[model samples]
Target: MELEEIFNEYILKSEQLIITKRSMNDIAQNEIKNLNQKKEKEQDITGNKNSTHSMDFFFIQDVKSGETTRYKNIRSTVDEKIKQIVLQKNKQYQWILSESFEIFREFLIKSYAYLGYKDKNIWPLKDYGSIILSEIENKDYSFFLEQTKTKRDVPESILNIFRNTFPEYKKLETCNKLDVNLNLEINLIEHFRHIIVHCGGKTDEKHKLIEKIIKKSGLWNNGKYDSKHYDFISSFFRLKESNDIILLEIESNNQDGFPNKYYDVLSDLMNSLNSVAYLIVNEIKTIVK
Candidate 1:
């Protein structure tokens, strides 16, 4: 496929995923609201003190137990739904990063081919071209190319290609900004994505580092900070705060246990990812032209 087409498709897909997440969030919010209303009504009816008979008391107790079960079930269902949505969103985020890199790689290879630099032995150029060519003489080009797909290095490698080919092409302001933003945001997202995907959302050393930073900042004291106190930390982390402060609950331990606040974080990340993808595509178009 054409490089431009590939880039456009990635951006479109990212935007669609963001819309899906937003729709699901709205549904979840409404469901929670309805659930709370139902719970309140049940409590009012069951807790009425007008009934004095022993049988009425037993009946009311039974009704209260049923209401509690229903409430728990509703809450559990909503939580699971939100978790699934979050997992899907995370996958889309990773896909955008990987796919963007892939398109950039293809563009580099095509650009080199266009320049009549077709020594298939070095089909995809690398940082150390001469050394890679030497190794290829003994092994194979595929082996050398395969080694270049390191996650953290791919963006830099692609940028290097752009710099070498279009030496006179001044980097667009948007691209420069995107380069900086992606370096920071993608690294942070990738750290969490690694844990979420490989370790089944389990915390790891990266998370510990994050915790240490949060602790040193003194925003959290034994995970007992008021919900309002999340503003500074959220802004630092580039996370969005939910409109309702009541949604933020102080758990016994703040050890990243998939709180509702994370939904806001995921939402903000998705929006940013879509924006970056669009900017990158525009930048690529300008450079390629």
Candidate 2:
């Protein structure tokens, strides 16, 4: 299978999106894990003989150079490997060939055209090195996933994606720095838009509070919020006329605190909240097939 055929006919690369090589790789890692996990889930759901042994293939959780994360199938056929390789290479291809690399922080709003996604911008360079790369000390590329604003669905799955992407950021900080630095108001909360969309804006009380906050605020284009309500927060940022500002403001009244107790090692990409969106999308696609 070719990259063009798979991504173009299948993957829905959202506009307002451009991923660094590391970020894109993180997504691919997460996607693979998600697929395997789904296979496991199905096995469990059916209670089959294969349940006696654990799957030899599991998502790579370490955030170091993902060289060790390559697929090593014990008995996969040619067709299966082709599909896997496409997913694998596509992840790296998006970042290595992102459109935003050239003009500093200028957002390139066009798909790779190499793969499949239409007129969607690749990840911006300034946002990566100047912004995320600087904050992270010398780590790997995946470390920058902390900067991503992903949708909500499988919490475990999304967390996995972030964990995988974190190291990539750590690694890239070695040789690059943003030419023009700007303060980015990073809002790491998943509740900002995802929760409101998951349950219709007016479904219940918790959701209503979300709807109320979003309505009173000036974020909405007219009266409508996101389609799924879990759109990436940055996917809808308002840029100033001067092209010098990235407005990322949060308006949550409730006191949100991080215990920092449960925080330990990060999970693999399949468990990532960010990466799970693609996984679910893939899963659904498989179902449709």
Candidate 3:
């Protein structure tokens, strides 16, 4: 397929992903509202505003011993239910963001593959150009794109691969467009992806890679000054640093796990990714001859 066609498909998929996230969030918010209404109804029936209802209880079973361990009063009230749902929805956000990064990564890989397929003159290593082109034609560019899902420095690694392969890549407008904040946000998204997939959204605060991105993004630097720079990163999520561990916590009010203008935040992140992808594709159009 043509490079532009490939990128167009990627952009469509990215848009759909954002739409799906927003739909799911709307469903979640509706559910929360219903739960609150139910809580109020139950309160009126009981004639006590402070009274709590036991809506559900949770337990775990021990298979070997044939014994069940019940957690008392867990998920018993509307408040608890709301909390659990919010946390689960936050996890869903992480998963969606993870998939978003994957889509972006694949777009990059495909663009490079297209270059290798169309232009042998631009391959950095003259001796192995034919072999690389053959591999790309066979849909076997894993040698170039594999291991790109590593826990850290993913954005830089992607640029490095292209830069090392085509020395002119460093001079490309696409490269120049990848300013520090954009790179920082891309890597931050990758880190959040790693936390959800590998660490379940919990990791040591001293995780050097995560800390580095946070510091560079001005999210936690200089005594936590509120910087208006990170439009998407700051709005969608916040770092909860405590007990020497970092958490992938969604920023929210005490009553809800979603922040004000939550859907806008998701759009902001998706739009930034889309903008970056658009820039790369435009540059690829100039090179793929």
List ranges where model 3 is wrong by over 4 Å.
Answer: 57-75, 126-155, 161-180, 206-210, 214-263
* lDDT, candidate 2, 1-289, per-residue tens: 2233333333223222333444554665576666566566767797542333232464554567645564553555333543565444543432222221211111111111111121112333432444454543454323333223232233323323333434432232222243210111111123322332343211234444445444433235676776443233333322322211111222334445733222111111111222323333343243233
The full ranking of all candidates by TM-score, starting with the best, is: 3, 1, 2
RMSD of each: 12.6, 23.0, 6.6
Off by over 4 Å in 1: 48-124, 127-152, 159-180, 204-208, 211-264
lDDT of each: 0.43, 0.32, 0.61
Task: Answer with 1 or 2, whichever has the higher TM-score.
Answer: 1
Worst 10 residues of 1 by lDDT: 242-251
lDDT of 3 by residue, 163-233 (tens): 56545444542345435355556667776677768877655543455456666554675555344544444
Q: How well does candidate 1 match the true structure, expressed as C-alpha RMSD? A: 12.6
TM-scores of all predicted structures? 0.47, 0.18, 0.68
Query: In order, how many clashes per candidate?
Result: 0, 44, 0
Using TM-score as the yardstick, the better of models 2 and 3 is 3
Lowest-scoring 10 consecutive residues by lDDT in candidate 3?
241-250
Q: For candidate 1, lDDT tens digit of each residue in 69-131? A: 222212233334445454454444444434433443444343333222223432355433455
